[model samples]
Target chain A: MAEVDEASKPLLRDLKAVGKKFGHVMYPKKSTTLLRDWDLWGPLLLCVTLALMLQGGSADSKEDGGPQFAEVFVIIWFGSVIITLNSKLLGGTISFFQSLCVLGYCILPLTVAMIVCRLVLLGGTGTASFIVRFIVVVASFGWSTFASTAFLADSQPPNRKALVVYPVFLFYFVISWMIVTFSPSHSDGTTDTGP
Target chain B: MSTTERNKNPNSTESWGGFEDNPIQGGGSAVIDMENMDDTSGSSFEDMGDMHQRIKEEEEVSEEAAATEEGDDGEFLGMKGVKGQLGRQVADEVWQAGKRQASKAFNLYGNIDILRPYFDVEPIQVRNRLLESLIPVRIINFPQKIAGELYGPLMLVFTLVAILLHGMKTSGTVIREGTLMGTAIGTCFGYWLGISSFIYFLAYLCNAQITMLQILSLLGYGLFGHCVVLFVTYTVHFHSLFYILWLVVGGLSTLRMVAALISRTVGHTPRLILCATLSALHMLFLLYLHFAYHKIVEGILDTLEGPNVPPFQRIARDIPEVSVALVNTTVKTISATLQSY
Candidate 1:
């Protein structure tokens, strides 16, 4: 009982410290605090929100063969894990969870772009709507890539930084491609595939 | 002394002393004297008189001090009473403080000289900054205060002129249909104010410490891009390239300004989200104008003519077949696996 009590005291203190760190992450600045004391809840919450956005976009899509909910969640989870592993293999100083956190939060812009593209599709499928969706997806893709790189890029070795960034770039590009291609499912089984 | 002797003597002070000396013999007269006396005793009455005199002197001194105080400060001269003066002074101080805050809110509009390059020259640097602002990064030193102020008014004038010109081009007459011109101008201004106010509300929700003037100025500068488009269209042919260029410039400038303003308050995630949403709205506005004002209807007809590929799709279609097949295969496999669940 005494040993457990002694252990619980330090654990409680550590939890309190982590709680404060989480507060800082909620209103993140260009500071190192988020990277210093990484937490799971922040990234998990963000991933769930991203998943919800993906699901919402799919639900509104005109195509019948869009990715399901589980597919999106799996893709995001596996994508983050793959990127984190790649980042580690490249001798990046950041840990697996920290990389995951950064990558997951970075998905925010693309998720927002997806929701917006879906909404724009609702108005009409004119060339103007396509242009609007294109601009949004491109801008958000760039933003997501930039935001993630701002945190993860510095952790990489100086010489191999470009190599590390390639994966990150490709990661966001794939997501943007998916968002751009997503369309609402029709009542019939036929899908309206974009060129 | 007897009561009658005291009354007849007419020397009341000496008689009172005599009565006090022979208390037993003049007991009845002393009782009557006590009854006629004032409620207060002699020593107490003297003390009360001294206190009243001191209080009157203090009042006069305070009045002099207040008058001198009011003289020292010219702002309180109009007030008649001391209380009125003090009250007015407090109110004046509050009013001055409020004025200082109001001035701070409008401080961006003060120095117009910094924007001289925009008017006198091409303002290449400012234009470059406008493009750079779209990057959603922290800019340590933006010459937004002065340049933005000048941009707002200039943009407003350009917008008005553009609307008038568009009216002239469309209706074939400006002076004949005065009400139409007036309505168009009113609609333009109303839309400008409405969109600016909406952006301000979004900034507020983000807890960004941005002033209304800053937002209005940024949006005004954005309108300057549209004015360029209008001028080009009016003078030359309505080319899609120029229209697209306007969209790029205006959209980027507005996006950069918004991102810069809210970068400090919101995190990177929310900031990018807001930027995307706002930029999307800007594109929608451009599309609306393209259809409403230009009446080109090319995009609409494209949509109607078979299953037309969107511009984005056309660009996507240019990618190598291998990468496209790879992405499709990966997505299909993953989705196929998840379908069982």
Candidate 2:
């Protein structure tokens, strides 16, 4: 009776904290406390969501997409790690996971864009649907880039800021591009969508 | 925090085995850890013998509680060994412990036993020292994060549950009883819902005006070929009959759909493309089922060795099996090094 702090209790707290952090990413202002201490919880949650959506939002699949999931998972994590290491090597003030936190958290806008793109994609492989998805992806891609750089750029030295932002730019660009270009695989050989 | 409570629950602290009745451990070592007090009294370690005795007791407790709970790091006594600030060894030890505890709490077993490699297999979240990973992120460390009710775990659970139903069955009626009935019921609704929705979406894309009910009833009849194929393949089994039936049934389904399109007078070119595409989609689904569960439909169940590989086992085969011996040796060395007890 003396101890109310049980396992389930902190989990709730942590989730609340995670939710709060997500809010911080949503409205990115000089939130370096976010930079000082960050958890991969939000980032990972976003990563998993993006990965599944990329593979077709269908829960039941007939494809062996082990490689595809692994492909997305590895690219995101490794890209962030390399970006983080590069920042650290350049004497950026941020720690490894703080950089990871910003890099991963900023993926939020892109993730949303991917969801919208996937749903719009369901409207079929026509020019109208394709144009709608393009605008959404481009808008969110810009938002993601702006938000991530806005959060990350201040941490770098004035001259080296471009160096840091470049990778971050590439990182978001690659993911957004993936969302843009992805097409569901058709089984029949001659059934390719004609240009 | 749960960290303190959990740490104490696994108090499997044998050094204090004799001191179980001591006032410090009397309250089941709940939130207020008496060990934290002992750890703070850092200056006085009553020499090597006392530490050895505590270490020996801890190992025994670890073995006992390991079958149930995961971490006893909350009962961790490494604090008494280090005096003021953390030593280099203690720092690394603390980092390693934090990583291990975090992984266990998240249900993430990395590297050697990469069970749920890419995504979180389990949806439950336990707040432990998990947020703080002190180890250097060297070249993509093992998959370590998963949360609940999301698509990664949700789809994984649904697909795994559907497949495991096949895994548990070992009998003479592997196909007829095990897969065929499941396939029939599943394809009846799933395939119907799937194709109709697909066609409706495709119609919208192609600027064809067709009502949902019209498409649904059309596609419902279109499923007759697949239903017939299911029963025919059920009774008479042939190796090539599967693919051969794929062409025939797929064509029939397409023809029925095209005939419905002709009556409706939607358009000319779109009808031809729609029928051909539907045929291709049907072929795709049949090819997937055949290739996915290859051996189960080989006509006579008596001739085959046993049940065919389950869908997930086929997915599992995609992961190159790591040798058990290598895993053991690496695990042994890691445990031996991390055994600060």
Question: How would you class the docking of model 1?
Answer: incorrect
Instruction: Report the poorest 10 consecutive residues by lDDT, candidate 2 chain A.
Output: A186-195
Residue-level lDDT of model 2, residues B8-55, one tens digit each, is 645323233343233433334432233443333233344556645644
The reply for model 1, stretches above 4 Å from the true place, is A1-30, A57-63, A185-195, B1-304, B308-341
TM-score of each: 0.32, 0.36
lDDT of each: 0.54, 0.53
| Per-residue C-alpha lDDT of model 1 across residues A15-116, encoded as one tens digit per residue | 676555544433445767657766666556656766666566447543333445665566567668766765565456887778887777677677778878
The residue pairs that clash in candidate 2, if any, are: B102-B130, B237-B299
RMSD values for the candidates in order, in angstroms, are 29.6, 28.4
Model 1 Cα interface RMS deviation (Å): 21.9
What is the C-alpha lDDT profile of model 2 across A1-195, one tens digit per residue?
425667578888878978887777677777676777789998999999988877663234343221146556766896798677656655567766788988898888888888787777677755466667777877887888788888888877776566566567666766775666554432111111111
